[model samples]
Target: MRGSRVLSATFGYLGLTVAALFFLLPLLWIVVTSLKTPEQLFQYPPRWWPEHPTLENYTYLFSKMPFIRYSFNSLKVAGLSTIGSVVSCSLAAYAFARLRFAGRTALFYVLLATLMIPYQVTMIPVFILMRSLGWVDTYYPLIVPWFFGGAFGTFLLRQFFLTIPTELDDAAKIDGCSAFGIYRRIYLPLAGPALTALAIFVFMFQWNDLLTPVIYLSDPDKFTLTLGLAFFKGTVVTRWNLIMAGAVISAVPILIIYLAAQRYFVQGVALTGLKG
Candidate 1:
């Protein structure tokens, strides 16, 4: 029995290691490719590691374009979007979970139905609205819509909120706390895991968003990292090395955020749907 258990553990570890390598090899290759020169990029037989790694590609990327500005723009839009989504979604979720109102369930179901409607279906209409409002070519179109909350975020948070005991709400009410006060003091503090998870989701979406930025923003100075990376492909030739470098740079903040909130993220996902 002990021997069988040992063999099972060994196989489990081996399988996990193989899975890790499967996902990591591409990222490793991107990092390696970013350091190679133009000549090494298209060698007859590709090199796993560059003979002489260089920072020239990264330097060229920064000097040739407003890469720093692009980074700042991405950060600004992602940060604001995350903040807006978290606040708006949490408030909406609280209402759906706790408040008594006519047609509350119907309204939530409508919101969920919206999630089934593809963004492509509304893309043209939304763009026309933005254009009519004179928001085209501005960050307003990129950042403002998120303040209204989203279906997925509301649903996720509402599920998590429902898991919390209503006795706490009664206790808060006994203390003469208003509905807003109960949410701010009790629910918000206890919903940390769900909030972190939602923030990470919203931030990642905004950070990697290319289509919205392309549709709304034409100014080079306002380009986000994803849009800026597209500039590396010229009509005549593409710079793979520079593109890889930009990809690495764009991936850093996401890695940092995931690592920082990984604990809460896992817990949030685990506990969110326990009740419903």
Candidate 2:
């Protein structure tokens, strides 16, 4: 039995090691390619590591372009969108979890049903609405919609809210707590891990959103990091080195956020899945 268990453990470790390398290969290649010189890029058989790595690509990207401004724009949009998503989704989730209202069950079901509809179906209508509001060229198109709770966010938070015992709600009510008060004082505090996880999700979604930005933002000055990165591609040729460097830079914040909240992220996911 001990010999069998040892063999199983060895295989598991070997499998995990292989999987890690498989996933890391593309990232490793991107980092290596980003460091290579232009001459080295066109070599018949590409080398894994750059013979001489330099920061010139990054330097040129920053000095020649308004890369910092683009980064700031992404930060602002993503930050606001994430904040909006959390607040709006939490409020909606609270209502769904606690409130007894007319058509509440039907309404919740309908809201969840909307998730099955493709975004592409509503894309044109939303674009037209934004254009009518004179928000076509502005950040409003990107940020405003998030303030209305998304189906997934509300559903996730509601699942978390459901896990909390109802006796707390009853006690809060007896203590003269209003609906808002119960939500703010009782549920919100208990839902911290879930909220953090949701925030991370919303931020990552907004940060890496390429299609929305590409459709809404036309001016280079207002372009987010994803859109700004597109400048490296031209009709004649593409700058792979600079693009890869910019991609690496753009990915840093996402990695940082995920790593920082990883504990809560796992906890939130687990708890939300428990009752739901």
Candidate 3:
């Protein structure tokens, strides 16, 4: 049994290491290529390192493009959206997890069903509805929708909330705490880990998103990093090195955010206790 356990552990480590390399190779290549001069970038067999490394690609990409403004737009949109999603989803989760109302279960299930359906199925209708509301070219179409709630975020939080002992709520009620006060005082504090997870999820999703930004935002000044990357491609050719540099820049923030909050993410999953 000891031999088998050790063997299984060894294989698991090997598999995970191999998987990590596979995932990281492309990112590593992008960074290396971004440092290579344009001439070295277009070489038939890609050089692992530039014969002469340069920051020309990143410098030129920023100079010729609105990269700073793009980052700003993405920050605003993603920050606001994340905050809104966390608040809205947590509140909704608390309601469904603790409170009872007519048709609550049915409505929650319907919302969950919406998650199974691809956003593409509702894309056109949503776009037309936004257009009708005069939101086509505005940040409203991007940031405001998240304030309603995300199905997955709410579901995760609800499962976590359900795991809490009911005694807390009963004790709070005995102290003359209103439902709203109980949610604010008792449930919200207890939900720290889960809320952190939801915040990270929302931020990463909105930050990396390209589709809605491209479809809704037209002005170059308002463009996110994803939309700004589009200008790198030409009718005749594209600046591969510069594009990769922009991509590296774009990916770094999300990487930093995840790394910083990784502990909370694990804690959140553990608190949910849903695996069984």
Candidate 4:
């Protein structure tokens, strides 16, 4: 039994190590290729380290492509969308968690059912809606839908708000607090972590999103980094170096934001997950 346990533990750790390598290998390749010159990019049987490292690929990448414009557009749209998601979701979450409106439970169930329906189903509707509003090819298509309150973010924050004690709500009410006042004073302050987590999620989703941006945005100047990478893949003979550089640039913001919010993200989900 002792020998069998030891073997199992060894294999488990080995499997984990293999999985880690599998995931990290692509990232490593991207970093390595991004640092190489064009001549070294497609060198037979790729080199682990650049033979002659250079930042020229990155320079050429931005120079040849409107990479800075694409990156700026992506950031602006994603940032606005994240703000909208956070505000709308937090307000709705507060309502669901604190108030007892007629058909509240049923409404929540319906909202959850929307999550069950794939985005593909609503894709056409969203497109038509954007077209009617004259928002196509503009940032509005990317930024505006977020204000309507997303299903997942609302549900996540609501669960967190529900886990909060009722006494806090009552205490605020005793101080002549209205519904909005209580939500603003009591719940909003304590619910920072969950809201931050949700904001992070919204930011990452929009930052890395390809489908919506690609479909709605026809102008090259308005392209998001996610869609712009496709252009890098097809443009030239020495594409790998530029492609890798562009990818790394795109991924860096997500890595930084996640690392910053990772602590709160865990607490929000861990605390809220138990409430259900």
Top candidate when judged by lDDT against the true structure: 1
RMSD of 3: 2.7
As for TM-score, the candidate ahead, 1 or 2, is 2
Using all chains and alpha carbons, the TM-scores for the candidates as numbered come to: 0.93, 0.93, 0.89, 0.91
lDDT value, residue 239 of candidate 2: 71
Candidate 3: worst-modelled 10 consecutive residues by lDDT = 230-239
- Per-residue alpha-carbon lDDT of model 3 for 45-138, expressed as tens digits? 8778888999987787678777888888889999999999988998899999999999999988898888789879988999999999999888
- Residue runs of model 2 more than 4 Å from their true location after superposition: 267-276
Per-residue lDDT of candidate 1, residues 1-276 (tens digit)? 999999999999999999999999999999999999999999879999989999998887788767788999999999999999999999999999999999999999999899889889999999999999999988998899889988888988998899899999999899999999999999999998889889888889999998899888887888898888776455216678878888898898889988888886676566545534
Decoy 4 TM-score against native: 0.91
* Lowest lDDT block of 10, candidate 2: 230-239
TM-score winner among the candidates?
2
lDDT of 2 by residue, 158-241 (tens): 988998999999998999999999999999999988898889888888889998999999898999998887754552156788
Q: What is candidate 2's TM-score against the reference?
A: 0.93
Global lDDT of each model? Answer: 0.88, 0.88, 0.85, 0.86
List, residue by residue over 1-276, the lDDT tens digit for candidate 4: 999999999999999999999999988988998999877876898799987789987887688778898889888988999989989999999988889999999998898889789889999998999899998888888889899997889998998898899998888788888999988888889988888888887888899899898789888788899988876576764677777888888888888877877887677567547755
Superpose all Cα atoms of candidate 4 onto the true structure and report the RMSD in Å to 1 decimal: 2.4
lDDT of 3: 0.85
| Clash pairs (backbone) in predicted model 3 | none
